[model samples]
Target: MNLCMIGTGYVGLVSGVCFSDLGNQVVCVDKDKDKINLLNKGRVPIYEPGLDEMLKRNFKFGRISFSTDINKAIESSDIIFICVGTPTSKKNNSADLTHVYRVANDIKKNIKKFKIIVTKSTVPVTTGDKIEKIIAKKVNKKKFEIVSNPEFLREGEAIRDFIYPDRIVIGTQNKKVNRVLKNLYEPLVNKGAKYLNTSRRAAELIKYASNAFLATKITYINEISNLCEKIGVNVEDISIGMGLDKRIGTRFLRAGPAYGGSCFPKDTKAIAIIADQYKSNLSIIKSTIKSNENRRNLFKKRTFQIMKNKIKNKTITFLGVTFKANTDDMRESMCLKMIPVFLKKGAKLRYYDPSGKKKEINKKVKFCKNIQEACLKTDLIIIHTEWNEFKSLDFKNLVKKNNFKIYDMRNIYSSAKMKQKKINYFSVGR
Candidate 1:
């Protein structure tokens, strides 16, 4: 199958590459000419593990290609996937579908063949209908079927998620579209994959509900972590015991500073607003959003409490600045919020992450070249994100240069080892 993937952001790029790797001819379209040039020049715009190698392999096989020419890509493909961004609106909790709409309008103007226009981006319910209406008004109505096929890939491990997802959801009323989508993903399903076929609206809601529910799980654990801290209990042990039950499977139960990334925070807000628009109050999801915000603030307080009388005029080093490890994405990272508090308290700070070369951190604090540089001569070391390297760092050597008052926010270090080092190690809820 030939697939035209619109937008080369996280979802689009990974999906395009994966589909191409599956032996489908793929032309990934992006509005950014610079990004397309980079891709064509064998450069990946995003820092995903093993992506460049896969791109090279697929590009060598002539199964994958890159382009800024949307019309050309659209005209040549039978399936056009609108994998553009539906980022949260600034003014409200609604999703800003400007990019989706623009792509729809453009597709309507150019395409002549019967195409399956799949909504691969996470969108609100009934957005497929809205997209269908827009395409109908501009093009021949018989030429396309808008299928809501929302992606469920997580950042940092997107390639793995894409290759082996929990399920493939296709939403459409047309039987033909269903059959075509089934065939499109037949390779994966044959290799033991699950499929959920539902109405377009239901499929859309499934995406939002899944993300919101995961956010709620994290928030639930975070809320419990707070109580555990107050009551003098190990939340990690409690969570582990609770997760052993068949009913409460272990996932997203790790207590951390908060869940802040490109998805959870925004999707929870958008869905809560969606429920509101439908006159259905989602109290739990609304609280989940509030819980996440409260957790971040609580974490900030906890950091300060650990640094009581010690943070004043001290050099602090942050281990990871990205929201999660493996990706350089720093949208709404807890460190972004926590760093200012330290700066306000008159602390010299330096941070390091493999992918933490973000503009936000560059403007605010010193960007260290490596972990050792960030830790050098710093009084306190804060591990914000559980980057793989942090777990296996030469801690004995790290503390040799400094007093090593550590705040392991993600609980990456064991309490026994911290005591062995005679270090003051503060973790979440323990």
Candidate 2:
């Protein structure tokens, strides 16, 4: 199947590469000339695991290509997936669909053959209807359908998530659309990919509902983590006990800094804004946003509270910066929030992430070449992302360094182990 992925951001780049790896001739389109040039040179802009190798293999086989010429790519493609970003708008918490709308109009103006306009980007309900109306008005032919096929891939584990998803949710009951989609994804399904077929509107709603629910779960545990701190209860134990019931699984249960990244924060607010527009009161989601905001501030305060006096002239090391690790996306990471707070309190920041430093750090924050440089002679060490290297650090040697104090926001170290190592350790809840 011939496919064109508009917008070579994280989603576009990863999906296009994976689809190409699955034997589809995929072209990734981006208006950014430099980014497209970078991709053509076999360099991936995003920091997804195993993506670089996949891009190289696909390019060698002539399965995937990069282009800034949307006209040519769209004209030759059978399926055009709009994977552009719908970042939060400034005026309201609603998703800014300017890019999506622009892409729709562009496709309408260019396409002459019958094609499927698939929305691989996470958009609110009724967006497909709006796109359908816009395309129908501009185009003379009627051999087109709008399919809401939201992606559920996470950042660090995107490749595995795409190849082996929990379930593929394709929204469209139209027989022609379904047949085309089936053929397009037949390669993956043959390799054990399961899909949930439903209506277009329902599929859109499912994407929002799934993300909002997961955001709520993170907020729920974060709020409880605060209460656990006061009552001297271990939030981890509480979560494990609560999650033991098969109904409540143990994912997104880890307490840490506020939920950030490309999806949860933006999608939650956008979904809530849509719910408000329809006059449907989504109080739980509203509260979830409040909780998340409070969580970030509380983390800042917790750090200050732990070392209010001692932090005046200390070198503090942050272990990870990217939200949840694996990707260098610092869009809404807590590190952005906490870094300023600590820096304002006269703490020198030296942080190390296996992937994110080269992308996120600026002149204000000193980026270290290695974890040793980041941890060397630091008064306090804080683990932010729970990267595998941070989780497996030598605690004994770290304690021997100058002024050893470990604050594990990601819960990479156990309370008992820290105590045994004689390191002044702090963490969320227990």
Candidate 3:
């Protein structure tokens, strides 16, 4: 199939590459001329594993291309996928659909024949109906079909997830359209990926609800970690015990810093706003949001206690700064909130992430080129993101200072081992 993917952000770029690798011709369109130029050179703007190689391979085969000309791409393709960002609105938590609607208006002008317009972007419910209404105002209803096919790609492991997703959801009641979409995804469907056909609205809601539930699980485990700390218990043992139940399989149950990523924080708030607009009370989700926020502050208090309120002039090193490792995204990273506060309290900070330096941190904070440089002579080592390199480290050798403390935020290291070495180690729960 010839496909046009609009807005070459994470979703657009990754999906376009994956589709092309599956033997489909794909053109990824974006307003950013620089990004399109980069993609045309077989280089990606985002840092996703295996994406650059896959993109370069497909581009070499003439299967994938990038363009700033939206109308031309739209005219040439049989299927148009809208993969623009629908960021949370400033005034309210509802999604700001300006980009999505703008793409719809652009599509209306360029549709020379029947096209299946699928929204691969995360959108609110009824957004497909709204897009259909917009396009119908300018073009005939039979000319195009609006679809809500939300993406389930996680940041770090997007490539693997796309190739082997747990499920593939297509939202459109039209039987003919459903058949076409099923054919489009037949490769994955053959690989045992469940294909579900549902109403467009249900498909849109599924993405948001799925994210909110995962956020709830993270918050649930984090709160449990707090209680475990008070009563002297291991949160991992609890997570293991609870996960043995068929009802709860462990995925997001790791007790760590508050859930912060492109999806969770924004989606949780948006879902609450959506529920309220429908005159429904989603008190549990509301509490989950509140609890996630408080989790950050709780970590702040723990830090102060660990330091015995002697933050002034203490040299602290953060192992990783990105929300989670294996990707370079810093959109709601817990360190974004904590780093500045530590600086204000007179703690000199340096951080080294596997993803490199972050712009979100204060200018005063030094960016170390490597972990060894960041840890040299530092008073405290806070294991923030669980990057692979940080998992097994000779911390005593890295710090090279007596009485240095290690705070394992992700619980990646064993507390018993730290104790055996006579290192002052702190971790979540136990």
Candidate 4:
């Protein structure tokens, strides 16, 4: 299959590379010249595990290519996937569909023959109907079929998720469109991946629903963690006990500062907005959003309380800054919220992340060369992201050198071990 993927962000780039690896010729289009240039130079613009290698291999094999010409990409492909970003609009917290609509207009202008236009970007329910109307204004109705096929790729594990998705949802009423999409994903279907066909609106809602539910789970656990702290109960034990039940399998049960990333924060807000627009109330989702926000703010209060409210001259080091480990995405990161609070209290801040952007971070904060340097002489260490490197740190050596306090925000360390070493340790809900 020959495919054109628009908007080479995380979803577009990973999907293009993986689709090409699956024996399809894929051309990824992006308006950003720098990103296109970087890809042309055999370099990735983002940090995702195993993505660079797969991209290089597919590019080398002539199965994939990068382009800035959207028209050319559309002209050469039988299927076009709109994998653009639908960020939360600042105006009303609804999804900003300017990019998606603009792409639809572009497709209306460039699409010449029968084409399967797939909405691989996470979009609002009934967005496919809007796209169809937009395209129908300029082109014949027979020229295209708008299929809502939202992606479910996680950040750090996108490649694996793309190659081996648990299930694939194709939203279209057209029989031909459904068959075409099924064929496009036939490789995965042969490998035990479930291919579900549903209405376009259901498919769009599936993406939002899945993300909102996961966000609720994270917030639920964080709330439980807070209660555990007050009652002197271990949240980990509660998580394990609950997860043992077949009905409640554990995934995002770990207590952390908050849930922050591309999907949860925006999708949850978007869903809530959508519910309000239809005169429906999603009270649980609204509470989840509020709970997550409160959890993020609580980190600052918890830090100050741990320091006995004397943070004016304290030096703190954050182990990781990215929302979660193995990806360099800082969008909606809890650290973004925590940094200002610490700085406002006159605390000196240092951080070490394997792939976080130094320039994008606050100028007041210092970026260290490594974990040791970041922790050296620091008053406290806050483990923000659960990176594997942070899990096996030499706690005894670190504490012996600086006698610094350890606040395990991700709860990656054992409290008993830190206690045995006489290290001052604090962790979430445990």
| Candidate 4 local lDDT, 1-430, one digit each (tens) | 9999999999999999999999999999999999999999999999999999999999999999999999999989999999999999979899999999999999998978888899999999989999999999998999999999989999999998998999999999999889888998999999888999999999999999999999999999999999999999999999999988888887888777889998899999999999999999999999999999988778888998888898898998999999999999999888898888889999999999989545667899999888878888788899999899998998656645646798999889899988997888999997
Alpha-carbon RMSD to native, per candidate: 1.3, 1.5, 0.9, 1.0
Error of 2 at 39 (Å): 1.0
Summarize candidate 3's per-residue lDDT along 226-281 as a digit string, tens digits. 99999999999999999888899878888999999888999999988888989989
Tens-place lDDT digits, model 1, residues 1-430: 9899999999999999999999899999999999999999989998899888999999988999999999989999999999998989999989999999999999998878799999999999989999999999977778889999999988888998988888999998899889988998888888777988999999999999999999999889988998898999999998899899978878899898888888888899999999999999999999998888887888888777777856778888889898999988888888888888888888888888888567877465888889878887678888988888899776658657645688898999898888887777888888
What C-alpha lDDT, on a 0 to 100 scale, does residue 124 get in candidate 4?
90
Task: Estimate candidate 2's alpha-carbon lDDT, on a 0 to 1 scale.
Answer: 0.88
Summing lDDT over every window of 10 consecutive residues in candidate 2, give the lowest-scoring window: 395-404
Per candidate, the number of residue pairs that clash is 0, 0, 0, 0
Give per-residue lDDT, candidate 2, residue 98.
95
Off by over 4 Å in 1: none
lDDT (10s digit) by residue, model 2, range 1-430: 8999999998899999999998899999999999999999999988899999999999999999999999999999999999999999998899999999999988998878888999999999999999998898977646788999999999999999888887788999788789889887887787788877899999999999999999999899988998999999999998999888789989988788899998999999998999899999899999999989988888887787778666767888888888888888888998888887777878888888888555455567788878888887788888888788887788657545744788899887889987887778899987
- Considering only N, C-alpha and C atoms within 3 Å, which residue pairs clash in candidate 2? none
Error at 43, model 1, angstroms: 1.1
Q: What is the lDDT of candidate 4?
A: 0.92
CA shift of 52, model 1, Å = 1.4
User: What lDDT would each prediction earn against the true structure?
Assistant: 0.89, 0.88, 0.92, 0.92
Q: After superposition, how far is residue 355 of candidate 4 from its true place, in Å?
A: 0.9
Q: Candidate 3 clash total?
A: 0
